[model samples]
Target: MRIMAFDYGTKRIGVAVTDPLQIIATGLDTVHPLQIIDFLKRYMQTEQVERFVVGEPKQMDNTPSQSAMHVKGFVNLLKKTFPAIPVEMMDERFTSKMASATIAQSGMGKKARQNKELVDNISAVILLQSWMDRKIY
Candidate 1:
């Protein structure tokens, strides 16, 4: 079975997927928030995703941020839409900063770095990897 992860934001949703064996996590794409549910529906049909791990934003003091509530709403929607699949939350802190640094360190040109969507997608990959490392053997 494969697991899917989402780094949800107001503007975009970054997606990542684990291998069927649940070993590797790879970035998929960044999609507009309005389109995320439709995107998941199409992708899940083909990939047979078994679970969803969503990144939940939290403050430095480990308190849930306002965005965490938004994420919770999204998770609730996911459960309603795909009741058969289990949904889990992963704490996401500094993931966007990490993604920005990795992009800068890659020596990409300004034009490429200006693509916010790319950074979101990379952050989603990192989020998924972190979640897997924390929970999986």
Candidate 2:
């Protein structure tokens, strides 16, 4: 079964998917918040997703961040829409920063590094990879 990951945001949601063997996580795309469910519906037609890993925003003090409320609402909707697929929340602290650093290290040009979509996509990859690593070892 394939596992999917989402980095949810008010403006954009980052998407990632694992291979059939569930070994590697790869960034899929960045979609608008309003279109996320529809996007998933279309994607699910072709891919068999067993579970969803959603990034949960948390403050350094272990409290939910302001953005966490939005993520929670989204998660609720996801559960309502896709009851069969389990949804798991993973801490997303520092993922954006890590994505920025990764982009900087990549060979992409300055303009590409500044793209919010790229950051979101990379952040989704980081979120999924973190979950996979935890699950594996």
Candidate 3:
């Protein structure tokens, strides 16, 4: 089984998944908000997912951000859609900025750093990795 993470957005949702061994997270795909469940269904057909980790955006004070409402609604939908699977919310503060910095530092070039989809993908990876890190200590 694998652990999946999502950096949810109203427009685009970034996806990442851990290896079967739960060793590391890797970028999967950027999915449309409307199509995410279907996309996940198709992915589940071939891959056994152990849990779903959704990014919960937060403000500097650690309160829920404006996007938190949307994320909560999405989480409800996700639970309804996949009743057996457990879902978790993780703070996503600065994941995007971190991703952007990572891209800029990676020397993937100017155009690559400008790609929101790429940034989202990396953010999801970071979210999952953060979760794993928290579990360790």
Better of 1 and 3 by TM-score: 3
Query: Considering summed lDDT, which 10 consecutive residues are worst modelled in model 2?
Result: 104-113
Q: Going through the candidates in order, what is the number of backbone clashes in each?
A: 0, 0, 0
> For residues 1-137, could you state the per-residue lDDT of candidate 2 as single tens digits?
78999999999999999998999999999999999999999999999999999999999999999999999999999999999999999999999999988988887878878899999999999999999999988
Worst 10 residues of 3 by lDDT: 105-114
- Please, what are the lDDT tens digits per residue for candidate 1 over residues 39-65? 888987778888899998999999999
Stretches of candidate 2 off by over 4 Å are: none
TM-score of each model, in listed order: 0.92, 0.97, 0.97
C-alpha local distance difference test of each model: 0.88, 0.95, 0.95
- Residue-level lDDT tens digits of model 3 in 1-137: 99999999999999999999999999999999999999999999999999999999999999999999999999999999999999999999999999999999998998998999999999999999999899889
Instruction: Please rank every candidate by lDDT, starting with the best.
Output: 3, 2, 1
Off by over 4 Å in 3: none
lDDT of 3 at 63: 91
Residue 17 shift from truth in candidate 3, angstroms: 0.3
What C-alpha RMSD separates each model from the true structure? Answer: 1.4, 0.8, 0.7
